[model samples]
Target: MINYSCINQLKTLKDIIRYTTTIFNESDIFFGHGSDNAYDEAVYLILHALNLPDDNLDMFLDANITKNEIRKILYLINKRVTLRIPISYLTEESLLQGYKFYIDKNVIVPRSPISELIQNCLYPWVKNPESITSILDLCTGSGCLAILSALAFQESMLTATDISVEALKIAKKNINYYNLQNRITTINSNLFDDIPIHQYDIIICNPPYVNTQSLNKLPKEYLHEPMIALDGGNDGMDIIKKILKNVKNFLKKEGILVLEIGNEYNNFVKNFQNINPTWVTTINTEKSIMLLNQEQIP
Candidate 1:
């Protein structure tokens, strides 16, 4: 039988995992009435404290963990359980399109489903895609989309534009991290301000689309992210509308624009009652992403 006193002062990886599981169960009561997977969150905290790679937990499931490590992990777990802070902020990293990008409060966590479309190269719509020589990622927070674009389309030149200087700083770090400085250029601009007037073959955006009403309802964990990246005015399509109106000027005749409007799809359609007939909509499990060809715009 395990001694309760000794268990409380765990010294091995095994001990820490066990303790974390226990604390997670106890903490769940505080998280909410019927929360599931609270233990997973606790385990993440443990892995973080150890500075362990994401797969390390699986590799060392039975390995011993030190007592001091248990204490530190427990403290972080408590902070998350009590404060409702997102684990991403604590970890300073997030995954997108199977690639890891460094993250902090300076930029929103990378969680766009647009990754799926990108991975497949926007098939069915983008035939003879060699024509896509230049691509633009507007509102390119953290530069995840831009970096991923370079990785996706090796032959294309990429430009990532953002309005926030702080966001641009984080994006630059990611660009440098991926060593994509040669293929990717970071610009500080509100939409198309700094972007060249020349046409682009593709423009991808996951812009701010959260309406004020929805913003007020966001969980505390979401509040930890940058509001400038989330709030999309009263109807949430303020930025989307602006982009739709001005995007035609920057696109080649055959270029396509892909826009991610999270949770604001209905409002978007309502605002733009006569959406371009050439525009096609793809609904991911989480949201609706619209694609419009340059020729369809005007």
Candidate 2:
């Protein structure tokens, strides 16, 4: 219950940010979508609503904010606290590795560690990016990774697929936003069910790996996203198992697959007792993403 009428009292950007942090903390709000903590989230929300450069927080910390602008910002904060909506959905945009993408309720926010992996072109795994000719991004929400991979491997053509048609619309919108429609194609498929006869140099996926037990403990903010992009069944390997069994067909004999199974490392090992995947090192953790070559699969 934010006192909307008192918004004018918080007149400066600095004032609003402090107030937001206090309010967010008092309300026990969760923050894992875009920003990691309340201070960063406050800065992002206030700066975004004010239509200011996100990086110029220091320059505008004490700058005066108009009453109408304060009202609008307060409205957003209220929605964020009371409704527990993610800041990206509230702002209608998300940033991954400095690249901005349009986001909405149809897809999850662009927060994958794969963004860093792709930004680095997969490092030692793939020494040369130009040699990559094709890429497939499964569960490509908002086309963030698909578009990022296309940018990373300039010579490669990308096919981004998702089971939800509504999610595909957002992905296509983002692809066109980056003017990558020419380099990326959108497919409506459940994993590999409808994928055409094509093998990719790289097959990256950030599928639904949240176990049923963990689903019950998820923060309310996560409920704002499409659950099809989150729920991964009882053991969290429902989609992972399918991908493991069939990804070999879509991956070239010499190619690699980068899969992200957030917080499911133990379950992943137990599910695939025979498979040994090279855990890809990310800023988060090595277990967050895994890399497997063609021979690694059965």
Number of the top lDDT candidate:
2
| Candidate 2 wrongly placed segments (more than 4 Å) | none
Against the true structure, whose TM-score is highest?
A: 2
**Per-residue lDDT of 1-298 in model 1, one digit per residue for the tens?**
1223554556567667776677666653233211236666666667778888767576877777666766567667666767766777777877776787888898887877777778778787777556678999999998998888788777899999999999989898989999999888888999986777978889999999999999998877778789989989999988987898899999988888988887787897688776753434444344467788876664
lDDT of 2 by residue, 241-288 (tens): 999989998889999999999999999988888998899777777787
Cα misplacement distance, residue 231 of candidate 1 (Å): 0.5
Q: Estimate TM-scores for all models.
A: 0.88, 0.97
Global CA lDDT computed for model 2: 0.92
Give Cα-based local distance difference scores for all models: 0.78, 0.92
- Evaluated against the true structure, the overall lDDT of model 1 is 0.78
Q: When superposed on Cα atoms, how far off is each prediction in RMSD?
A: 4.1, 1.1
Error of 2 at 80 (Å): 0.8
